[model samples]
Structures are given as C-alpha cells and as structure tokens.
Target: MTTTSPLRSEDRGNASVTRLSPFQPLTDEQQRLVDSIVRFCERHSHDGHAALVMEGDAGTGKSLVLNTAFQRIQSEARDRDSTRSLHGMRNILLVNHPEMIKLYRNIAATIPTLRKKDYERPTSFINAMHKSEQRVDIVFIDEAHLLLTRTDPYNHFRQSNQLEEILKLARIVVLVFDPRQTLKFKGYWDDAHLRTLLAGIPTETISLTEQFRVEANPDVMTWIRALCDGHLLPLPAKQHFDFRIYDDAARMYDDICQRNDACGQSRILATYDFPYTLNGEDHFVQTGSFHLRWDRNQPTHPLPWAERPESIDEVGSVYTVQGFDLNYAGVILGPSMSYDKVTDRVVFHPDRYEDRAAFSGGGRITDTPRAQCQVMANALFVILTRARQGLYIKAVDPALNERLMLLWKERG
Candidate 1:
C-alpha cells in the first residue's frame, strides 16, 4: 500500500505568507484577569517581585492572555513619561518551542511597538540574563511546564532549573503552565515543584475554567479529560460538539484532506507507534490498508507541517503538533493503545510505544508502567484537543473499533 511521497521540496516555497490577523476578542473572564495582571505589573515595574502563575488545561485561552498582556504592557511602557520611574522598562516573551518563537515573531512584525527579538527561547533568555546589566522588568513564559530541569543537555551553564534562572532574569515573572502538556522526561516543572521553588516569594495563582478550543464545548472537554484519566471509555455521544469514530483509516485521512481544502487548516495525527529515525529516511505508518509517511524533517522553516501544502499527506506526531492549533484533527490510534474487554477500559502498551527517550534517562521520574502510560495518555489528550471545530478518530485495534461502533449506535 506504500505510494509515492507526496511532500516535495518545491511545495515548501509555495506556502502562504499572509500576516497574522489580530487576536480574537478576549472573553469577559479573560479581560478581568488581564486587567488584574496588568495592575500587578504596573505596581512592581522596578522592584524584584514574586511570580504570577496562570494555570489551565488544553484549549484554555492561556496563549491569548499572555499575548494580550505582553502587548498591553509594552504600550503602557512606551506611553509612560520619561520622568516617571516605570518608564523605559524592558519586557520579553519566553517560550521553549522554535516554531512558537517564529510564529509569534511573524505576528509581532505586523505591530509597530513589538519587535521580533522580544520573543525568544529559554536558553537565549538565560544567556541574555548573564550579559545585561539591567534586569528585565517583565518576563512572560508560555508553556512553562516544558521548562527544563538540571538533567537537560541544553543546561550548559549548570543552572539549577529553568524556573530559578527565569526568576533571576526578570522582576515580574508571569508563567502560563499546564502539567498535562509535559511530553518529555526533561520537562520537570509541576505544581508541587513550582510551589517549592517559589517558597520565599509572594505568588498569585489563577485557574482558567473556560475552554476556547474544541468548538467551546465543555462536555467535549470533560469527556476527553475523563478518557485520558482512564475514568471512562471512548463512547460516542450526540453532543453539541463534533466528534466521530471511523472504522477506516483511509476514509479518515480523506475527510481530513477535504476539511483542509474547505477550511484551510486540518491534518492527520497519530501516536508514536512506528520507529522514528533521525537519518532523514522516509518511514511510512501502515495500518491495515492505509499507508503514509511520517512528517518530513524540514530544516529551514519554522513550522513546515502546518504551513506547507504537501504536509497534508504526512502524518504529524505529538512533537510536531504540540503548542499549535488546527481547524480539524483526525487522530489515528495506533498499536500502542488498546481496549481491554475484561477490564472494560483502555490500556497502553509501553513496549509498543516508540518514543523511548521520553521513558528513558529519568530513572525515578516515571518508573512504573502506570506512570509511563499516563504520559502516553497525556500525549493523546493533547492531540485530541488541537482541533477547534471537529475531531475524527480511527482505532486500529478490532475490539476498540467495535466498542466505538457500539457507542455510536447507542448515541442514536
């Protein structure tokens, strides 16, 4: 069933280069929280202050809040009188993903006050902290859960942890974090660990309950969360949100392509069940009759999978799809996941899991099988919530597929 590779080098340059539109209007809850955060920044513009942590799950407007707050703070700094004490304060947005940096930089280029350099990676921000004589006034970190610990190879300067170094870099630190989004073994930050790090400092923590993604349906989010936690099965329901179970992989892929053609943003995602090699060879994901290559390694571009047209034929993994959103997401449950008819629940097969690095190196971090399975579950949950409008799912296990079909019948 292997076919010719659909991704070509020529298709890379044909990607659309339209400027990012203005951010969606903030909800009333988001606006209220933003106002409070801005007030805190204004009061502690000069002094070294405690960090403010914003916690939320997938689809919550954490990115929206951080982006809006960064722009508002920059405007306030520019408009302040030169004689005022808070004038000329420097602020920067810190993130770990290179694609996210490029994405935000491209968006910032459209605004007059914002600069591309304002968005940076963790290592770059830490290096800048050592050179600059003046402390950064405000630092906003998106995806704070991805912060590396001392075990990370990127910690060349031997910093204790990312949180410690970031606190030293800025007086007013703002972190947007979700513990469930941590995909790698090196990502060590959590609620307990963060609280321990900020023991001596005064901190304010806020929780976001509203979900802006997945068609803004709370029921869908609840079901996804329950499924990830192994509290419920993958049952179908006739809810307001769009969710479907497909018996054929090819049909699911075809539907994803059609959605992309009509909506301009859609892709197929799969679990890391196939061996991933770094040698740049094409490895196809073959399930039953459906066969397609995994996403290619594009060295030059920021986010080739989402930006390029040919990427529509490639299947994206968690590493490529994380920290990004899509109009529709078609998820393929590979060999790693299965349904236990005896227990009547979903189970993860660790031996079949391909991302060995995520399980290795951290001897005590994820020792038990259940712990490793939880990480895999987290990866699945992240993929499921990437879609803003709809979700199409296909399971490879026969028992799982049959159960899904039965659930759909029950929904009627």
Candidate 2:
C-alpha cells in the first residue's frame, strides 16, 4: 500500500510581509566554519568537491552559521565583478519546512544584497534539479534530518535518498542535522548512515560544542536532558536560569501571556494528546482549567509562531516549533505522559499519543512499546528546550504534579 503525502498545503492569501531584525553576530566556532566554506568555494571554482556535514544539537547555532555564510558568499560574488571567472557562481539554501521557507524569503526581501531566489523548499529544489541541466555550485540544507527517503510520498519521482539526489545537483553540499530532531517516519538521515553513503566522496565533519540558545545556561540544558531520559529529579538551583513547575494549567497559560506582553517572545506548547479536527476547524486542548486551540491557520510571513499575535492564544505542536526558539515557553504535559507510582518513573501511552504518522509503518528498527515511548520522550525534549530565558510546565496528571512538587521542594 502506498502512503499519502505528509506535507499539508495551506492557503496563504496575499499576506503582508514583515521585515525581521538582522541576524546576531556569529560565535567563534560558527565564524570559523563560515570562513572555511568561503575559502573552499573560492579555491574549488572549477573542480567540484564532495559534501560537508555539520552535526550539532538544537541550540548550537547551525542556522546562524548557514545564514552568515550565505550572506558572505553573496557579498563576495558582487564585489568580485572584475574577476569574471567567479561571477557565475550560484548558491541556494534549502529548508524542509514551508513556513520557514516563507519566513526566510520575507526576511531576505528586506536586505538589498540577499536574493529571494536563493531560498527554497527541499522538494521544490529537488524538482528543479531534475528539470534543469545546470548544476548549482553549493547547496546549504538546514534541518537536514527532515529530508525524506525513497519511501516518502514526496519522493515519487526519485528512486534514491534525498542526500544522493542533492549530491548529484551540487559540487559541494552542506548539511546541518541532528538525529534526535527526527520527528517523522520519512526523516531517515543520521550521522552513521550519512557517512556510509558518502564513503568514496571527500567528507569533512564539524561538531559545535557551545550552547548558544536556552539562555546560554549549561546547567538548565543538562537538567532538561536528564528529564527527557526518565530521570524525574530536581535540578540544582542556578542564578540565571528560570525553571518553574505549576500545579494549575490556567495559571501557567496566564504566566506565558504575561511573559509575552513583557518580553514579546513567549508561547504555549503541548504534546500530541488531542486529535486535530478533521473538517479543517480548530480543536481546543482542554487540560484542567486551561483551554486553547491548536494553531488553526498557517501564520503569515515575516512573523513566525513565537512572534505572531494569533499564535499567542494557540498551542503549538512538535511540527510547528521544532526548529524555532522563544523567550519563554509554557508546556502542558497531557494524559499521554504520566507518572508511574509503582515504578517511580515517567511513562508514555502510545495509544493516547495522537501523532499516528510517527509510528504508522514499520520504519523504526523495533516498533515496540518501548520505542514509541522514546519517540514521544524526544518530542517533549524538543519542546522543553525551545525557550531561551525561561520554562514553565504543568502536568495534567495529579500524581505527576505531586511528584514534581516534592522534587522541587527537596531542591529548596
């Protein structure tokens, strides 16, 4: 049986575009990578090379590095007009998310040097590669883990994985990926698998070690990792990190609203416990006293989920907020996640989890209950790490709430 396409097309009717602020200055590691790419492009103007893979976790500034390199290369191309040999060098940045592609195009429109044509969705770029005879000099793929394999519905025309097709279209391909961020069945890229695919080709790997997001607090990030790994324990107190556990979901929602009013970048997110309405209508996620709908409409360009006014009252799922960040995050742990008093651990119910697409086919190595639990755990881990300055959480299960409260009290 053939699977249907997972990409949902939305109607974005003439939405007014907003200009985003300029990117932050790159860290030392990010700058070095950018410089190396620039030098490689200049040195290999005639002969093409293989691919370069950069592995980094969510908050390691991979996006920053790619954007900086893009801008720098465009500026250099314009300045080297006298050097006719380098004038024809072409490059493009491919992102897997549609909303992100629209967001980047709107941002690129404001800058005089940046071209909107340089940004595209991965599927569109792949189609273009098949149609055109010309090969792009370099292709930078963000969120490379989201690239689909041959089993995906979107890969109907191609017989091979996305990485192979991408390598055929460009001399130098740069991929920024993290295995833990793979949230769908079709996302088949991992470090070990990618290395094996590029065995004969020249490949260079770089790992980013510094934490640039989540308020740059290593202790808070450590605690988050532990929590995802099933360690239901209290975190050590830190001076700058803001972590709080709330008994009431309504109160947590109110706090998120207030944080957005004060700081401008806060959002409420929840697990895939509630099924989205089938008739294209919004469905409310009612947990305790708190009630809100999932983001019904696609957000307009320029202002993304964390920045849009409509998103303030709507709850985001893992798909919408995976590759984004916010100033503060209010996370609701729904019925799918619960506390097992007998085992003294956090447990996941696969039946209660609504994201059936994640486990529909036998894509996972072992499609057992334990594997499903790990997938859900990773989803929560992604949502928890989205906040830069603060994190607020509400557990719907009373037993889980009491256990968290006791842990918090012990830390005090």
Candidate 3:
C-alpha cells in the first residue's frame, strides 16, 4: 500500500506556527522602512545597483520588516499594472540559517503570492545563479551577519565572501544585520568591513532601537546588556518581567516545563560549552542532575526544533534558537564562563569551549584571547535575547552561580 503526503497548508498548519509570516501587520516604523525599501528597489529596477541595510538587535522585528517588504516587491514584480511600476522583475530571499530557512519556506507555503522556490540559502543561490549566468533584479537577505566571510569547503561554498558574490548577481540587495549576534569566525562581520563593501554604491541604512521582544523595563535590559559586555553588575528589580537565577539546573528545567505548559513556545537553551556533534549520535547537556540531549539533526523534518513537541525535552543551542522568540527561556551558562573575583567580571575561557566547528580554520578573527572571548560572549548574548516574556538562568561555575544568585537576592 502507498500513502500520500498531506497538502502543504495542512502540513504547515498542523506542524508549526512560525513568527515569520508575511501577512503579519507592521508597526509605523516597520511600515516606513518597507516603504523606503520599495522606493529604493523601484529606482534601481531598470538600471544601476544599490544596497539598503536594516540594522537592529535581536527581537526588534528585522525579519518581519524584510518579509513584508519582500511580499510587496514580489507583488509589484509580477503585476505589470501595479502602481509601484516594478513589472516582470525577478527577486528572491536568502537566509544563512537552516532552521530559519525552513521557517521561511513553511511561511511561503501559506501565502498565495509567495513560492518556496523564491527562498534559498545564500550559497545555493550564488552557485545556481552563476551556473545559469543570470542576474536577479532584487535580493533580500535575512541575518546577513551569518553570511560566510571566508570559504568553507565542507559547506560546498568555494567563494571567499558571500556578500560580494551576492552583490555581483543582483541589481538591488537588502540586508538585515546585527553584528553582536554573529557567532562564528567564518562569518565574522563588523561595521567597518560592511561600509567598505558599500563604499562605491548608493547605500541607505535604517536603525531600529526599540525593544519589541522582551517585556521588561529599561533596568532589566541594562542588566542583560551589562552581563553580555563582561561585567557582573547588580541585578535590577524586575516587576513586570519574570527574571530568576536558579541554584540548580534541574529546578530551572522544571520551571521551564511549567511555562511551556501554561503558555506555548518556551524552552531551555545553552551556550556552546557542551559536547555535541552532527554524526548521528545523541550528545546530552549535563548540569548537576539535569541531562537532556542537544537538538537533533532532522533534515527531513519540516518543523523547526523549538516548534516540535519532542524538542521540549531537548536543549536548544545558539544555532537552533537564533532569530526565534520564546515565551520564557531557561539558559544554562556552561563551563566556558567563569566569574573573576579579582576583576569583578565574567570571563570566557576559550580552551574550555567545546564547539570546535566554530573555531575551525579561523585566522586573525580568533587569534587573540580577547577575540575568542567576544565570540563566546556573542553566543551567550544570542541565548539571553531569545526570551520574549521571561528569562531564567543557571551557571555551571560555582563562583559565577554564587555571584548571580547574590545579585538576585540583592535585587529583592
């Protein structure tokens, strides 16, 4: 007997509800940004090449703005009578993250005007366009910071820089980038390099500053910023937001499960200090008595790691949780981090880090101890910013745990 697969709508609706919907309404700021991007694309559609960059931290809805603008561009490109006057122009959207690419493809299935083929990974898009000897009218890139600056033969990308290759194949390019969320040496990016790339071209930048994800006061935001900046400051009083420092990892998992039950989209996350691999083996993140496997590789699975029901029992990493929003996140600061009593700051030990793939083939980017520290700190920064309503944390280092617990107590 043979079985048939479900319709795309039925499959997506039953499996996952993503945050990257093209139909989601935009705020006034988002709307203005979209209008500006559309205008830029219109001016460049017939001739000339230019770039527009949207800069913001996590949870500022960068993806939302990009998706909305892409939909408008697609509509105008397909409709000759449309007032925007972008008719029969080719366009596509690219994202470096596999999980985010899956989410965007699932979202495209639901929208009538959007096609799954319209979305792709940057590497694949570059190679395919090269083979066809074709140039697109417009290209949209989400999480541009994750684009590879150096070639990786393992990933089948032979080009030196992804952004440069993309610029040569598209008339207009729009990117959403946050340098602080950059996690790997291969994808290292900063303001200087990006500006140098756009030096000769007509470029426009939009900076989004409002915090739209974490439902917290300014003090709480400041505390998180300070912690990621390597400072061990006093915890702030958080009345509206649920912030907690747990003495035990097991206790934090229990509470995260409760949050997942009470409300959907809550999970536990960790830095790259744990042992994990992609060789089809189950590697667990162990802290105290709390042991859960890291997120598995599900190539055939349509749903993202966080959207899967079984993933509640798994611990997410920076790769799985980046560009995703959770109701509550329980973060375990693993062995790579320690509290320095002499300097009164949080220090990162690169030798203790276990994510070997991140540092593999790294050059000047990971040469200095300070640079290695920043890479790990950025991983923690991504983990810390995933929570939308609440944040819970547990540190594996005893001194770090004690410092955080004492700060929590003093905040009360």
Best by lDDT: 3
- The TM-score measured for candidate 3 stands at 0.94
Native-to-model Cα distance after best TM-score fit, residue 366 in candidate 1, in Å: 6.8
**Model 1: worst 10 consecutive residues (lDDT sum):** 12-21
Models 1 onward score TM values of 0.90, 0.88, 0.94
Candidate order (TM-score): 3, 1, 2
Candidate 2 off by > 4 Å: 1-23, 80-86, 154-158, 299-302, 364-371
Q: For residues 1-412, write the lDDT of model 2, one tens digit per residue.
A: 1111122223122221221223556678877887876666666666666677778877777777777777777666666554644455688889887666766787688777688898987777888778886688888888888787555664453545777788888987878878777766556445677777788877777778777667745667777787777777566575576788888878888777778767656778998888875466878888766778886656445655644666777888887777677778999888888888988888788899888887654455555576677778778888998887899888877888888878777777
Model 3: how far is 394 from its true place, Å? 0.4
Ranking under lDDT, best-scoring first?
3, 1, 2
* lDDT tens digits, residue span 1-412, model 3: 1111111111113222345676776678878888998998887777678999999978888998899899888877777677665878899999999998888888888888889999999999999999999999899999999999998888889999999999999989999988888788889888888998888988989977777788888777788888988897777676778999999888898888778777767888998888898999999999878888898989779878867767777889998988888889999999998999899999889999998767765685635567677778888888898887899999999999999999888988
Quantify all predictions' global Cα lDDT against the true fold: 0.76, 0.73, 0.84
| Candidate 1 residue-wise lDDT, 45-76, digit = tens | 65667688999878777877888878877766
